[model samples]
Target: MQTVDKALKLLEFFRTDQPEIGLSDLARLAGYDKAATRRFLVALMGHAFIEQNPASRKYRLGAAFLHFAQVREATLPLATVVTPLLDALSAETGETAHASHYSAGALIAIGIRESSRANRVHLDPSEILPLHATASGLAFLAFGPAAPLEAAVDQGLRAYTAHTITDAAALRGAVAEVRRAGYAISNQGFEDEVVGIAMPFFDSSGTATGAIAVATPASRMSDELRVLILANLHKAALAATAGIGGIPAEAFVRAHGERRAA
Candidate 1:
């Protein structure tokens, strides 16, 4: 188990920005000695999970992931199902709309639709959102399983901006508010001058497995705009949840239904 954990942790070190790492850097990043890291790397290479560039002597992810991703998409087609809803949400609100999937204590951006406006918020599909510092994360914490909250607290809330909630107690309060409102609003928590409004989307088990969010520039936000965004966001969330063959919790459905009716 420890070996498997170490191997998985090593893979996570490779990201969109830092796509390659030297042997020494990999050892340092993984907190393992050079010999152990090399052994792990050799094992991974054998499975075509990691490949080394001969010229730079740096390691990068191999083609296995591409095949795996293709297989997953062919089977699940989650992004295909969610993209249209995101497009509609972005069109309605004139903001950047996105969807995230909760997996292994992380919220990963999966699909996005940027507004046609020139000054729209930008998002990277590879970004792993901080659970305490984004509307998508907050909505997941409020409506999803309890393990993610505990994991976030244990990992320590690293403040990305001055508005980020760093205190565990404060984070709990924020999550409570989300639960009550059936959605979450993040104001410059993850990035300055950006606001995110999010609604949780559930899985077949009636547990929130992901979220749909609209990100807009703070300069453009207003009470009327917020209301308009929420109204469209609820419809998008419901369609996305059902499109993915998921079941929203009764409370979630009730809250949005009442809000829309009112």
Candidate 2:
């Protein structure tokens, strides 16, 4: 299990901005010795999870990810159901809307619909949202499984901006607020200029599986806009939850009261 974990951990470093990485740099980032990192890389290469760049001597993600992605998309199809919701939300609020999934104890962006407005926030699919720093992650922390919350706390909170909640006690309070309000809000918590709102959703088994969010420029936030976003999000969240054969968290349903499909 440890070997498998270490091997998968290597893949986490590959992101939208840094897709390829040299062996030594990957070792440093992963905190594994060069030899162990190399061994893990070699194993992953055998399965086509990572591939070496013959010219650059760096490594990038391999074709195996494509195969796995295809299987997941075909089977789960969560993104297909959520994309329209994001599009509508983005259009309604004139803000960037995104959907994310909580998988393997981490929050990963799964889809996005960018507002055509000039000052839109952009989010890339597959980007890992920090559990302590993003509204989507905070929503999950508030309403999702306790294990993920505990795991995130154990990992230590790293502040990304001055507004980020780095203390465990403060984070708990923030999550409690989310529970009371049936959604989560982050003001410059992850990105210095962004204000975001999100609500957690569940999967077919009635387990919390993901979240949806709308982000706007911090300067654009206002009480009226906040109310609009929260109202729209409640509708979209319920629709998404139903489409996925899921249900909203009991706490959220209780806080906001259940709305039937119109």
Candidate 3:
């Protein structure tokens, strides 16, 4: 614990107003020896917690911070605001419905409801999925910050099941489809038994930072039903975005117009 604490303190130096810090200065600011600071930095680099400039020999915070910050947000009190939406979606669709939001670099399930149908695919509210692997992923990917979307494709798609698309080119095509359709649909990408459809939550910047989806058992829902479910989910996601001050009428119109052209 003490080692971790000291290491974290060393990181604080980078957060200082200074743009970057050399090992010696960082050590001095963090109250640690140069050798200790070096050790911490090496470990952090291994996990991509810090980035070093090759020529300058200075360190700065890395993308890992963004991922961590996002995870922290996911654990906060989002249930109260999301539960009603989850319930309504599930009740109307008769499918397992969920609300998830983007945090740092992930899609976290903040709320969920199981379908009343006799047999249905169900996802636990506590479960979180990758921002790279579901209908949820496609929805956000179609509208998230451009960098993460490219990074996700660069990281390579992990095959969750036989139906999951592993080719970057193919995935890009799917994103284009989602952009055109104003929603995303996945046929057993994460789970072979579940087909999910989702729509993005546009943020104040017009970036889709989060999404909501419904999962139905593949054996239970036909393609036409999935299409209907996606339409409903798109509406709910838009409502959620509007409630969160993420979508202005002008922004929505622009996004919709772009989709039509795409």
Q: Give me the candidate number with maximum TM-score.
A: 1
Q: Which consecutive 10 residues in model 3 have the weakest lDDT in total?
A: 248-257
- lDDT by residue (tens digit), candidate 3, 118-227: 79887754455765569988888887777767887788788889988888889889987877677778888899888888888776788887788898988877867875
The digit string of per-residue lDDT tens for model 1 on 56-90 reads: 98999999999998999888777988889998898
What are the runs in model 3 whose C-alpha is more than 4 Å off? 1-78, 248-262
Q: What is the alpha-carbon lDDT for the whole of candidate 3?
A: 0.77
lDDT (tens digit, per residue) of candidate 2 on 2-85: 999999999999987998999999999999999999999999999999999999999999999899989998987888889899
The superposed Cα distance between candidate 3 and the true structure at residue 61, in angstroms, equals: 26
Evaluation by TM-score, superior candidate among 1 and 3 = 1
RMSD of each: 1.6, 2.6, 11.5
Q: In model 3, how large is the Cα lDDT of residue 52?
A: 94
How would the candidate models be sorted by lDDT, starting from the highest?
A: 1, 2, 3
Question: Candidate 3, TM-score vs. the true structure?
Answer: 0.66
